[model samples]
Target: MWDMNFRRISGLLRRVDRLDHIDRLDAASHSAHEGGEGFSARHHRGVFELLPGTGLTLPRHAGVLRFGMSEREAQWAVATLADVRGTWVCRAGWAFTACYEGLELLAYGDCVDLGVSGFTAVHLHRRGPRLTEPSAVPVVLQDIDLFGYPANEVLAAVEPNLHPTVRLTPPPSPADHLSAVSLSAG
Candidate 1:
């Protein structure tokens, strides 16, 4: 069992190093700028300034992508803003992730654990990229800068009462900072 767990973790670790796929991401970014087929021009140049209660709801949408939408719809929603990293299966469900400069968007589908289908959940991460730099896209939640502001400050600003429905997972350690600002499909 330990060996299996180790292997699974190893595979996950390998996937985390996406620097080698820079060309693919670059191509996607270029096409988005050129307004290539199926890619629409993003508003505010793809900087996602999210409103917590409106867009970042646990039972609803994450930005423009809504819960219960198909994987293709989710892809289309973020096509101009990110590079889709393809799909993978895990214990919780099947998921596809997309990458941005400093953010990562993960959408889940066909979740056996939850006995649900379609895109059930979407997560937005501030620490998604393994690179050393901060996110290129500015992600703001309720006027608080998710990437630019200090983690503790951001946390304090988005206290639980602010949006009782949204799930805010703080970093394990203070040094680690804010890793993700995510909401589940309630």
Candidate 2:
């Protein structure tokens, strides 16, 4: 199923390149005066930004868990966690987690490098003026039943640290499935 979905989306993206050719040409017209670069170059530039340095890294205490989970499951877990965490932090009346410069720089750098393929950003808020305060909310994991009885109840969980929450939302339908595939491929 995953393979089929991937193929379908890959085909669509390839089609997008063909379909957008005319638009690209039009965009290139405006750039004729600026050294005659084409639209594709402009598009690539718009999509990518270069960082001055290697960029920031997750804190020494921070860690990521990449276990024996399927790509879909990992995406779902991260997405759900970001959603719940955003709501929790918002209710607490604090700024979103991405406000930290270190985390922000790291996230943007990573996204630019990797194209933010399967990630979704969720805004988290908390009450108070102190930027360094810890969150009181606890991370939780829920079992998602992707199928019937004895379902693939993998332990999907979320961990909300000071970093901005970026996750992958579950593909709930055919359209979403296609979108997910297209995104992952890019």
Candidate 3:
């Protein structure tokens, strides 16, 4: 599983680099918006590319609060994610980001492609039903800050994801069991 997912992520890294070099993302949105590694068949549904120097933009999501963070906010968010279980730690265009993989699966496996650079984070969400309609809605975040962002912004982005922080605890390993047995024998 690890190797497979790693390969998948590695492929995504290369594709992201390819997309980054292009001049007009708008012109190349669909073509450059590469699908992910078998997460879904419709990976090219909608694409929102985040560029450098764009401070922060919150995509217009109906129920999901998808947005990038300031440096301080990003570091803090990392801490939050690090504590969570089943999170997808991503290397986006030379920066870092994480996703709640379990929650996504629970939510019918919605794909949220997030990219982070030294000073920016870009995201795209798939906003259509596979059986219902085959259309894509691209989301573009706005420039804002944690301090200036609307209330519940952080909450919305971080709340549904919080449950994972408790679910990723691994059970004791065989080595640990052996140590306990040896202690009892001694």
Candidate 4:
């Protein structure tokens, strides 16, 4: 786990370094033009501002979901309703998709790095605000909110976090099966 975090940090540093080099190059080129508007420090700062997003470590905040359920507790509150669906909620501008079945947390996740692809990983992680506190690299969620955000915002927050629902297709109708049998007989 430590190695994984180290690798993530190292990758972000490399990206920041690369952006710095690019900004330097851009400034140099603009400087070469005598009368042209060279990239000012202010402008450079603004452009480089986007560079930090690549290193964003999104925090998974815990709060009542879209339906008002708090995650501050370690365990789910209701354990009887075995299979109720889950939902996403937001607070402090952060989104938390929580799965609570009858007051128990089936799962919760925050969509951070969507492009990250690797082997299946399952583990416990310290979910807190430190992840999004202005950095210079993108960190993957080691594992997998209710602010009444608009649909678009909600989708943006949770889309990356959701895995496609896995459900078996309903069995073919008995009538269809019988019809196939009759056809085969004919």
Best by TM-score: 1
TM-score of 2: 0.22
The models' CA-based lDDT, in order, is 0.54, 0.25, 0.26, 0.26
Task: Give the per-residue lDDT digits (tens) of candidate 2, residues 97-184.
Answer: 2322111211210133443332222222233433222122211112111111111121122223211222223333323211110011
Clashes of each: 1, 5, 6, 14
lDDT of 1 by residue, 24-109 (tens): 56557878777764332233234454444334322112346656677777776766556677777675456778776656777677
lDDT of 3 at 106: 12
Compute the lDDT for candidate 2.
0.25
- Sequence-dependent TM-score of model 4: 0.19
RMSD of each: 13.6, 17.6, 19.7, 21.5
Best by lDDT: 1
Per-residue lDDT over 52-110 for candidate 3, one digit per residue giving the tens place of the 0 to 100 score:
23322222221221233333444443333233123333433233333322111111111
Off by over 4 Å in 1: 1-44, 49-63, 89-93, 127-134, 162-165, 172-177
What pairs collide in candidate 1? 102-135
lDDT of 4 by residue, 21-138 (tens): 5567677787886656666432333211100112111122221122222333211322221233444432121222222211112223232243222111111122232322222221
TM-scores, all models, native as reference: 0.57, 0.22, 0.20, 0.19
Candidate 2: regions farther than 4 A off = 1-10, 14-24, 31-45, 48-94, 97-166, 177-186
Task: Supply the TM-score for candidate 1.
Answer: 0.57
